[model samples]
Target chain A: MTRFLLQRIGLMIPTIFFVSVIVFSLQQLLPGDPALTMAGDEASPALIAEIRAKYHLDDPLLVRYGKWVAGIAQGDLGISLRTQQTVVQLLTQKIPVTLELATLAMIIALTFGISMGILAAISRGGPMDYVARCIALFGISMPAFWLGILFILLFAVKWRILPASGYVPLTENPLENLRSMIMPATVLGLAVSGVIMRHTRSAMLQVLSNDYVRTARAKGLSETTVIFVHALRNAALPVITLGALEFGQLLSGTVLTETVFSMPGFGKLVVDAVFNRDYAVVQGAVLCTAVVFLLLNLFADLAYAAVNPRLRGR
Target chain B: MSPYVLDCIHPFARGPLPAKTGKTLLFAQQAGRIEPRTASGKATAWQSEGPPQFLLDVRDLRVTSSGGYPLVDGVSFTLNRGETLGIVGESGCGKSLTSLALMGLLPPGMSVSGQVEFEGADLLKLAPATVRDLRGDRLAMIFQDPMTSLNPTLTVGYQIAEGLIRHRGCDRREARDRSIELLRKVKLPAAERRFDEYPHQLSGGMRQRVMIAMALICQPALLIADEPTTALDVTVQAQILDLLAELKDDLGSAMIFISHDLGVVAENVDRVAVLYAGRLVEEGPTRSLFEQPQHPYTIGLMGSIPRIDTTSEWLPAIAGTLPLASDPPPGCRFEPRCPFAGDKCREESPDLAEVSAGHRAACWKAPL
Candidate 1:
């Protein structure tokens, strides 16, 4: 396991490096010069040139990329053009919100998705199965932003049970923070839970049909043990893989959901940075998103090895 | 002694006269061809007697799909205590389904009916919970492919001990010791060291041993082995078969050994039932069935087993595939494939009736 971790982490360096290059190049491709955007619409050419010089916009692409990467190497992500705050500082403030939201959403998704999936599979073609499938269908069909809005209207406007749109750090007040996060996290989780449900249901169905499951039944295991203990462990493999990827996507910050909930997360930060031509912040956010995806992939692999011992020896 | 053994001897020695069935006359050489008035009368007679002689008595056990199409049509047999009964059939002949039905493990949408009387209770009529309690406690099964039959995620020892834990209510430590002992009984090498290994770590034979250990952990009264050795190497197959025989003897468990291989069945079982399509075409003492196969399908099956004693370069093959359950022949399920199938064979399904005292054949041309 230690060797596996080390190997996985070693592989991440090149991946993150490639990702940084891609994000930097892609940011350069966006329309409108950063200097001109920063100088404002009616600014004179001289003012724009001065802004460009100040930001080292005249440097060769490679030299600018080198400078950016060097700053990152020293834990400096450069300063956001819009706010004049370091990209690192901005991320530190926003990462916690998205991380908490994603983790909570993942917990909710896994619980409902796996339990409902197991239920749906065991009682296949029954009323409960249909209900679970219909709920999944609804989840997959409804947009997160739209669902967030609907949840806000119902839970906040209509019921006055939750805050409509706001942010509260957990350290500031855990209960209040959870209250504010509930709608957004649930809205974010629904679609993924639907994906997880479909995957888990199908995986469970296949695993339940396996020969070992029959052996388990023949062993006189109760219906629960047969389905959950014998079957679910194997079924969980694919679900975990998909879940980790979904969680990584969650960590990247769901733009529409954050906007609907007025939660200042990575998605909002990156969107604002992009719109304002804050090259440094965009680069940092994209690089961090890449790292999050890579880390999740690693975790998924480790989880796979853990659940299926057949993979461990190798 | 098996009642059938005593039953067959008495009738054969009497040398009864030929029996008429429609126009055809069955041979008198085998003896005892009188038909019973009704099947229920026989059951009543057995019940009126002191205690049931058979360990497991199946009467007209039928399995049908949700659409009411038959998968395993009316099949009946009796297993004596500690006796091994082999169910022989080609692929798609419901050999596995018959065993699954007995275990109450048939897949959803497949309905099983009729009687499976085990230990004085009709398994079919028993509540699911009752059947479940009986399953791993007094009844167990070893499946066809050990490679897949053992859960890959679990340790071999843990899997073996699972039945003990569930049925015997053994604590983990007790279950573990018993499982290791069983592993040794199955002749698995390094039983102690191998206990914690997963299914994939074991070879085909080793995995099968683990499966056997699992089935034997509870020392079930009846063990259903469905093509247990079919997935092993030829040498490994023999070892596993020998292991099963030894274990069955040790436990005195009645076994229903389902196999398509007549060779394996002949060597391992005392009596054999030959299933053709969804029907039991022939059944008798293994020795008699192999020596004198009464049904055409059974004859075909025996003829198809490649023989070292034969001079022929190419073995005779049973022609055509098994008919689909959805569109079975109107008469005998094997009519389309049977070389001896006549007008009666095509127009009417034959009931499994007495040939000799203990031997029964479903074909009208029995004793051919």
Candidate 2:
């Protein structure tokens, strides 16, 4: 099992290398020149040239990429052009907020999504199943931004139950932070839950039809035990995959969610960096997101081995 | 002892015949119950007044899917205590469906009718809760494909002990101890070490043994084995069958062994019932049925069993497939495939008629 994990981890090196190359090339190819954009239209050509030279942007694309890779090896991600601060410093401040929101969202997604999925599967043709299906449909169809606005309007603007939008640091007051985070987190979580719930329900339905489930019933177990203990555990593999993937998505894709909620997260920072043409900050944020996604996928693979011992190979 | 007294004491235990004095007492009892002058009076209510020897008595059982089409039609059989009754049929012949209906484990949308009397209560009329209670306690089942039949996440011991803990109300420690005993009974090696292993950790044979152990842990009155050995190799199949036979004798549980393999059924079961497209076509003592099959389908089944003595180029094959239950032919279900099918066979459905004493067949041209 250790050997298998080592093999999988070893394989990720080339995968991440290729991913980094693609991200770097794509960012370089964008229409606006970061140096020129930072300099602004009124700036003199000499000033632009000096700024480009200072940032080593005048170098060949390949040379710049090599430098970037080398700098990454040294734990240096360069400095943001717009914020005039180190990329690492900006990320350190912003990533925690994003992580907090995503973590909360994931917890909510897994709890509600899996429960609703199991409920829907058990109920099958009942009214609760229909309601769950409709909720999932709404989650899937409605835009995240729209959902966020709807949540804020319903819970904050009209009901006055929560603050309309903001990020409260956990250290200040954990309870207040949770209350402040719940609305945006729920919106983000629900959107993700729809996908997770759909996958979980379908997977569970398939597993329930398996001969083992019949065997469990034959053992004279209660229906709950047959479904949850026997069927659900087997069904969980697909749901696990969906959940981990959604977690990675939540980490990066919270830009629109953050903007609508007015939360100060890495998503908003990345969006701000994109608008300001802060290449270093964008690079740092994108790389961090990629690493988070990669780690999540790795965690998911490990979870598979943990959950199903057959994968451990006899 | 008079046969009438024996019958009154053990109704389900009555064999094919009664002793002379027992018959005399039975006649006396009948005479006392009804007027002697009547020629035919509702066949004397078909009473067998005695404590049951058979654990399960399923009579004229009909199971229909939600579409109002019978999946198992008019199937009647009994499982004697410590004896196995094999129900053999091709796929879609309602063999598995019959077992499912018996267990009250049919999927939602399917409905079962007719009497399924387990112990003494009519199981068909039992509430869902009562049926749930009865299952695992009095009635248990094992299924095909141990790979999928055992829960992946649970330890083999836990899976085996689950039924015992649930229905038997054994505490966790007691359940675990009993589970180990069961595992040992199934001949799993190092039963203690293996107890904590999950289903996937064990080999296919071991997993199947775990399944069997789980089914037998509760010491159920009846065990319904639905193609339990189908997924195993030929050698493992024989071992599992032997193990089941031994276990049946030890536990004294009546077993309904459902399989497509006639050889397996012949080795394990006392009585054999041949089902064709949701209908029971032939039923008799296994030896008699195999030696002289009364129905054409049963003959085809026996003939199709590859024989070692005959050096024929091609073994006999039952021609055509079993008809779909939804749109079965008018008369006999097997008429389309039966070589002896005649116009009469096509026009009228044959009910199970006594071809020989205690032997029944539902074919117009019964095998001589």
Candidate 3:
């Protein structure tokens, strides 16, 4: 298992390298120059050229990419043209807020999705099963941005219960941070809950039909133990896969959610820097997203192997 | 007058069957002995045999699906202490359902009727909660496909000890000790090492041994083995069969051994009940049933067995598959497949009738 995990991680290096090249190409293709955008269109041509040299925008694409990779190797992500702040500095400030929202959303998603799935499986073909399916349908149908706006209107504007949008540092006041994030977190959570629910229900139903479940019942184990102990353990393999995928989605960025909420998260930072042609920030953010995505997948694989002993032992 | 009644449906002790149990003379003899052995073994030894102690008595057991048609109709049999009865039939002949009904383990949505009398308590009459209490305690079952029957993730020891802890109220330490003893009883080598091993770690034969240990841990009075050795090879089959017989002898538990293989059933059981399409068409002592099978289905089954003495290129198989039980015809359940089917056979079903001193067959024409 350790060997498999190491191999997976080793393969990630080349993958990230390729992805970084693609990110650089996309940044190059975006309309408008970073130096011009930073210095303004009316600035003298000489000043623009100096700004270009300052940000290494004057260099050829290959030389610039090489220097960028070297700086990345030395843990320097360079400065954003839009903000004039180091890419790493911007990330360090915004990461805690994004992580908090994503983690909260993931927790909500797992709780609601897993419980609904178990209920649906246990009460298969009954009303509860249909209800869970309908919930999945409704959740997946609505766009996260639209859902976030709807929540804002209903809970924030009309109810006067929550702030409409924007983020607060959790350390200053944990309560307000939580209250502010609830709407966006819920919108994001509801988006992925459908996938989790569907997977859990199908996996659980399949596991419930296994011969060992019958054996457990024949042993006079109550229905609760038979389902939770015998069936759920086997069902956990797929749930882990779905969970990891969803968690990776959460971490890489919830773009629409942060935009609607006006939150300064990694997702919003990436979007703002992209439009402004802030090469360094976009490059740094993409790298972070790729590394986190790969790590989440690796974590999922390890969890899966742990649950299914046959995989680990073999 | 003969001491035994001639026409009674006793599946064991082939002779003039006693008219009824509790005659004063037989009762006095049992009272004289401080302890008695297995009913069949003791009955074989003493000239004066008392009323046999019944371990399980199922009467007119009928299982119907939610659609209200009978899946298993009018199946009845009695098991005596330490006696072995083999229920033999092709797949989907209600053989497994009969055993499941006895244990109250029928799949949901299938309705079952008729009395399941075990230890003088009518099991069907008992509430489901009571039946649950009896399961893995007084009545236990081990299914075919030991590969799939055990929980894969749990240790063999945990599966065996589950019943001991739940029903017997043994603590973790005591249950562990009892589990090891059970493994040893099933003749699993290195019981201590095997106790902690998971199902995948063991071979097919060893996993089966673990299943047996799980079933027998509670020392149930009646054990239903549904083709326990069908998945095993010849050598492993014989080993498992021998282990089962030894366990039955030592534990004094009545066994209903269900199998499709005639050889496994013939060697292991004292009596045989042949089912076709949810009906017991013929039943008698194993010897007579094999030699002079009166019902055409039973006769056909006997002919299908491959014999070493006969050099026939093909062993005759009972032609055609079992008819679907969804809508049974209004005659003998086996009439569609029976080559000996007469007009009467197609017109009416036959109830069990005495063909000899003890053998009973459900057929229109007997002693064929």
Question: Residue A37 of candidate 1: its Cα lDDT?
Answer: 81
DockQ of candidate 1 against the true complex = 0.67
**Candidate 1's residue-wise lDDT over B89-161, tens digit each?**
8888899999999999998889999999998899999999999999978999999898889899989888888
- DockQ of every model listed? 0.67, 0.50, 0.49
Pairs clashing within candidate 2? A212-B149, B3-B22, B11-B50
Score candidate 2 by DockQ: 0.50
lDDT of 2 by residue, B1-368 (tens): 33332222222111112333354334333323322111212121112346545567889999888999989998998766666678998888899989889888898899989999888899999888889888888888888788887777778888888888888788999999988988999999999999998876788888888888988888888888999877775446656776887887798787889988775565456678899899999988665676678888887876665443447677578888877777889998888988888999998999998877567899888746
How would the docking of model 1 be graded? medium
- For A197-223, candidate 2 gives per-residue lDDT tens digits of 898899989988887787777766778
Fnat measured on candidate 2: 0.84
Give the 10-residue window scoring lowest on summed lDDT in candidate 2 chain A.
A305-314
Interface RMSD of 1: 0.6
Better of 2 and 3 by TM-score: 3
Q: Give the candidates in order of lDDT, highest first.
A: 1, 3, 2
Q: Interface RMSD of every candidate?
A: 0.6, 1.4, 1.1
